[model samples]
Target: MKTFSAFAASKPIASLWDDAQAASMSEPELLLYRSNLLGSDLRITNFGGGNTSGKIDMPDPLTGQTAKVLWVKGSGGDLGSMKIDGFATLYMDKLQALKARYRGLAYEDEMVAMASHCTFNLNPRAASIDTALHAYIPKAHVDHMHPDAVIAIAASEHGEQLTRDIFQGELAWVPWQRPGFDLGVKLGDITRDHPNLKGLVLQNHGLFTWGNTSKECYENTVRVIAQANAWLAERSDVPAFGGAVRAPLDRQARLRVVERLVPSLRGKISGDGASGQRKQGHFDDRAEVLEFVCSQDLAPLAALGTSCPDHFLRTKIYPLVLAFDPERDNLDEVIDGLDGTLEQYREQYRAYYERCKRPNSPAMRDPNAVIYLIPGVGMLSFARDKTTARIASEFYINAINVMREAQRVDRYVGLPEQEAFDIEYWLLEEAKLQRMPKPKSLAGRIALVTGAAGGIGRATAERFLQEGACVLLADIDANALAQAEASLSERFGKDVVASAVTDVTNEVSVQASMAASLTHFGGLDLVVSNAGIASSAPVGDTSLELWNRNMDILATGYFLVARAAYRLLQEQGVGGSIVFVASKNGLVASAGAAAYCTAKAAEIHLARCLALEGAEHGIRVNVVNPDAVIRGSKIWDGKWKEERAATNKIATDDIEDFYRKRSMLKLSVLPEDIAEGVYFFASDLSAKSTGNILNVDAGNAGAFTR
Candidate 1:
């Protein structure tokens, strides 16, 4: 095996397991540090795909006695950013004792219950299924990961022999066994027989390395994976671009194909909208998808299963191959062909499940293809949101790379279909589905928030996301727009949020922004017209330029956006909602705010007109009149705050307090408060309500309207 110690760039390695270094750290801190470090390495694992554990002694909260505990990575925790809560602390002896009685137990829910029973009552987080595999090793620290290099060899036809050759006698090999009590028991037996074993290679699964310290185990894993990569490099002569193409494709042409085909494919795989009308799935156009589509071996090579069967839950067994030619076919023609193609895929998927499913297996999963492989064009990932689509894309790209390398070393092979079915329908995964937090009020819905770079608009976007709605932020400020998009995407999955530069007053820009939303999310369900400038001026002094600017944005902007969004909703036959961010000044005139007041007033009245018109089509239009909500608001950013304070003869710092003290409740009106009112109208909670005016001003009696 090649050693990683000399390679500075291979991965950060610890030369030795220094007890003194470890003794200085707490158990949770040590585990968290190691878990984060492991998860940070993309080659080792991605997102929430791996598990790590340590056997330690801690005072049992229930008994106040020092007890041996197994701290394992908990289910539903992201290893890259985990904390103490991310681990489930279980009594190790109790887990070990279950082995004798686990002889004939089922590998699904029953196994899960037995494992859960081993966890301390205080640790409510569910332990990982692989906890038993770690526990069986009887080591201080154990690490299990599905690194791409390791999976390449592990999933090949000559995987076992190759593993033997690479590790020689340093690692023990376990034949393919579905991960559960049986697999754990087998591991225990192997460890007992070979007490000198440093690591294990589970065929078609992953790698496990154990050591006396977390550092040792982590280093061992890194070193072994490095060795696997070196071994493959020495043997495999696979060209990066596999196969010579019949026709070399242009990259720009391929991207055009994606732009044309993805929207159509998204529409084809959706649930029925209002009264059986068609809705569309979200599409994420990925560049890596082009690798397989442009490959010479696209046909046979793409037919291979995932990097491993464990990836089935994400990427599925196989991708859906669609034929597309940007130069030859129209998008409509491609979509017309898709109906029959998707039908075939569904039928085949159903049959595959029937052929491979065990007794009492869960119902077959939805037959929609997650990855669409276009021969001439690139690939597009389809899912309910962008994050899932991206994840599917990541797994498929890894699968393609792994299988390509495996074919170079030997013939590429995959886990048996039945084994894949079990993992796909594993009760643990099902239980995870069952345990999923109830869908938010607007889950699966989409919303577009204007002026989203800051303030009330930004809050509304966040609120929409919190309620399970995907939001596309539109702002004129390119820098702030990009920043907001990045921040929101980081918090939510990139799939759930997008951003576009929009000058709502400009017809072309407004139209393009709306079009981008449909392309990003497949459809639009809600529109929040909140973009405006705080151009406060008395009616006599208000210049024509200021009047037109305020009118174009506050009133005309709402009209342009609402008009476009209305057309989309009407075409999809799925009625949607529209909320205008009117101000208290719109209802009650304020001196030196004539331009602002008139524009907001016009905006509110326009919403009322749209509400009357939209009511016939089941679309709801409402207005939110909010008082000053200055925190983090672009409207409140820059000299606006200082300018407003100067007009009021008050210190800038006390401006928010002034607004707070003016309300009947003596509390400031918040952006979230306005968002709640918007949510009520956007959601089914106000299905029968239209032309409604929600005063979110902490009891602004003067702003009340009949």
Candidate 2:
């Protein structure tokens, strides 16, 4: 809501932005930095959704002393694709001075002061409005982005209240306001208040936090956003827009509209179009209908915009009106009516602010709604330029869709009016707004592994943790499950692992396990249906109980787990991945193992079916078949072991060699190797792959024998 003058100057900080991009820079260092930033930023936001900055000291030509400058990402640059040039430099001393005087000066004055101090050689590219905030950070590097999940929660009714409840004293909350000096000053003040605070949350705005180093900042951001995301997801009421007609707008038009509106509304926006069209269509006819459509539906449309509050600078709080009519088309009347609609919108916004503000807070200028459209007429968003407007419109549309759906569950609830005010005026959160930390690739991701007490399952859990994923380890054996958790915790730490005693054969147990996984990780992403009982019994001699048990775990268990994962993953909307751990018996027959073979074969087929069914929901399903993994397993200690020894007329020691030499490779396959295959299927590397049955049997099945 804070507006600054266009003529405001930006003062650069000393020792903040100057860094050598010389040829001598280590390739590994460069690659590491780039990859780290890219991965972290991308996870925080969608493609090109966030920004980053680094500070370095340069030798002052006259003083010979190091001066700091900030190298911030330029507008329109994606953190993922940002190069050294993508950053704009600002003097550190000037920036810090601006923060000191920020309380008394108008936002425009602050900007002018800062801009006047830019380096002579630096191209006169407009510094990001958030430059002052970035300068206030003590860290050498900073990254910022509007993560979709985090913003979705922050933009909702009671968002501020919920944030305060979840984060408690850990975070600073800033109210929704335009980004620039006013926001920076407020943030600076708050940061001073909470010296140890890891991050700041702008109510109805995006998140911001920094660290002494890039990795620290990135990790902190991931952890904080994850906390918010988990909290919100738990309380959210996202619904399935079942069999609804997809939006009718062309992709190009959608993007163009978003780009234009983003700067005007000052928010980030992205998502599918169905919701936007539906919301825009709600106000079919009006000269300023575009703005009305963009603005009036702020709560519902929160999802499509930059996830955080500060995005409003790019998109504006609302779009301008084109025209409005419930029934017919009248583009000319709508266009002519823009001025009046805008006036009305401004008046209403001021009234809303006045009604909501506390005695201590200063009132913000009422900006016109970000959207306006007339029925049967094209809609447009007004902003400083087309790109900003387009971004705003896109985000607005997306928010509308979310709002409409949320309405089905509960009338679109947004942050309480007081909470919104607090965030809009929060100084500490604004100060921390310099750069957001990058999110871990797997920060909010969830994984569930059956038979997790076994070596392969445990290994998979460990690997997932290393990649930043939260894991739910499920097993039928209570003692084994407990021990697995203890072992995994010792290796990977406690927060990364959770264990559930699950009997996959039981539908209720499967359901409970999945629910626990969701509760533990906040959402479901990957599932490893690896729990199965192996037995060696010939066809006629196999007990009915044995056959049923085998089928229950290997076949029916897979079906149940897949079904549970699919439901939760679909609810999440991000594509999910699932891997079924079958065995060599699935592909090749073996004597005295009818039930085992049948169960394995059914599991493989079940996975194929799930892959087909899950594709519609963006869930990938695959199978991994491993043969004779013998590391710390009861499979070599129980009845099956005795039976195998008797039937094969050999000691258990020789039995191991017997299975190993049966394969062409004559190599002993380890459980970790199978775990590797599971990882491949569970990650983005195999995004396009599904319905695949990968053989990890040491080439035992032979090469495509006809």
Candidate 3:
């Protein structure tokens, strides 16, 4: 892999980052220059993978004098978008001194604590554990990454020989050693022995390249990767498996199996976290996963360790395989088969843990399989959140591709199971895991809210997030929905909020929203049917258009969302809550508001009917009747507000105060007040209450249920 690159040196660094510390290191900005370009390519290093380092002269804290310092990619920052501060600066001599102490330290020894004492600045985040390895290299710049093409060669059985053939003088090889102080010291030894080498490939791991200039280091990486790709491509005509007849994937049948399999699989693995608490996990069936897992050779190839040792951080060493046939079995048969498969998988995983775990290590990790391979179907990945599930899925798909390419050249081999476990459960990774905050009460639950762009919908969506539920905000107003999503995600987190443009009145649109809910967050637990409009008209004066619009959105929309969400709940075999945002106008007759009143009354009755039918399925359906809540409410906009003011002989601005005094408590009805009612029904606080009507209008006796 000795190909050359045409990369030109970047211009002088400018102050264009949120991190001021990073921008301040503008002179000799080689580290920042190289890191930016390297991080931009996902194929090179994705998410939080890879690190770059440089040697620079800076003032020393202890000596109050100028000294050479090692500035490396900080522990938690992403390289593609890293700023100057992303480079964790440490005095070279101090860091070099700590390396000797790490020689035989126990795996449980705190690497971060030892490195903390060497930091030139008191940055809170820990430095990358590979600091020593970078410092020991005499070159001006070093780049370490797990590029897929490089990993393909490292994972092959003939990887060591292939490295010798491709880049005879430019490259060197290092046998697989779990990354840490020991590995760092070994790398230093390799550098001294082979001073002329341009790069080093770590078997069953990744690649490392160094140069006197940042441009040279960057070019060496690209050229080496391109050579690996070209070499693999030259001999790529080989089939994935040796001459064996294989059956094709039944696409229709596989989809059926996926639909029937996800719910049962979710239930079996729900409570397998370290806390042993029943945390809900999301599922994903990517197109790439289907193309790979559906092949006959998947089970055998995937049974081995991950594409690289570091992948074990997301997808454990190996995946679980299950048998399924849509053509020969019913849902019950599928469930029984999964139960048996899951039990066997659990037994094998526990055995693997006992066999590999070192003494005095942290407790065994959750035994649940992150990736599942089903016969004749696609791969299914599960995790506590959508982002994690997607990460694992993407990694596995890449692994399959890498393994396939490696097999064409020679038999594919990866790090031994024990070594993979060591990396998977390493102390450095454990520290990162320990930092995760405690989960909320409804942390893993998924909620669907209609009319989420405004009024009660927005308020209820925010409330659900506060209680730890991932919410999907649905609304017909695409622009407003996008804004709501951005604001909510900023307040909460992007992973906890998703938005869908949904016309609740249309069956196709509503069904698509339901599918998105499952696709994004695994399952639906709560349905807040709050999307509707208010239309006022007496019997004779009401136009057909106004009447139909009210009925379609207020009445039919509620039915459609509830029906779609309820089916998913039943499939999951887990109880869920459905709350309808009905109106006090439904119970108390309001003249000239026939269409709005009638539609709301119908919505309340629909909730009662659903409650009766869904009771046996552990589904709860309830209603919250809010009266004249004018604040932040789109329902009270335009004609509704004008008409209210005209009726009471007051200014349009006085409409809010009029409704506030209309209630027996004489208190203003805010959107949050109504949201509280929605939350009560959605949470376990109302677990036993169904077919119930909650009056959220302070003291509206006229709208109260008898």
| lDDT agreement with native, every candidate | 0.76, 0.60, 0.76
Q: Write the per-residue lDDT of candidate 2 for residues 508-583, one digit (tens) a residue.
A: 8887787665333334668999887789877889999999988887888888888877876664455679999888
Query: Each model's TM-score, in the order given?
Result: 0.82, 0.45, 0.86
| Best candidate, TM-score | 3
Position 214, candidate 2: lDDT: 56
RMSD of 1: 5.2
Q: lDDT by residue for model 1 over 171-288, one digit each (tens)?
A: 8878888777777777878977888898888888788888887777778887887788777666544443365353424665555554445444554565462112223334433433
Supply candidate 2's per-residue lDDT for 690: 94
lDDT of 3 by residue, 1-706 (tens): 1111111111221222334444555534767877887877766766677889878787766678988878898887888888887788877888788766663746425655688888876765568777767878777788998777778788889889989987886888888877776677778788878899988999878889987766677777767776776676666555553322333345555555555566556656763323243343444444435544555466677787675765767778888876554345555676777767777877888888889898856788778788887654667777766556777776776676567667777778967988877777776678778988876666667799999998899999999999888899999999999999999999997877888999998999998787667656666788999998876666898899999999999998998999988887887766789999999987887887899889999999999999999999889999999988888987687687886677567999888888888789999989999999999999888989999999998787778689
Model 3 residue runs over 4 Å out of place are 1-29, 100-112, 241-260, 271-290, 325-336, 374-377, 465-468, 476-509, 539-552, 605-618, 651-653, 663-668, 684-693, 698-701, 704-706
Evaluated against the true structure, the overall lDDT of model 3 is 0.76
User: What TM-score does prediction 3 earn?
Assistant: 0.86
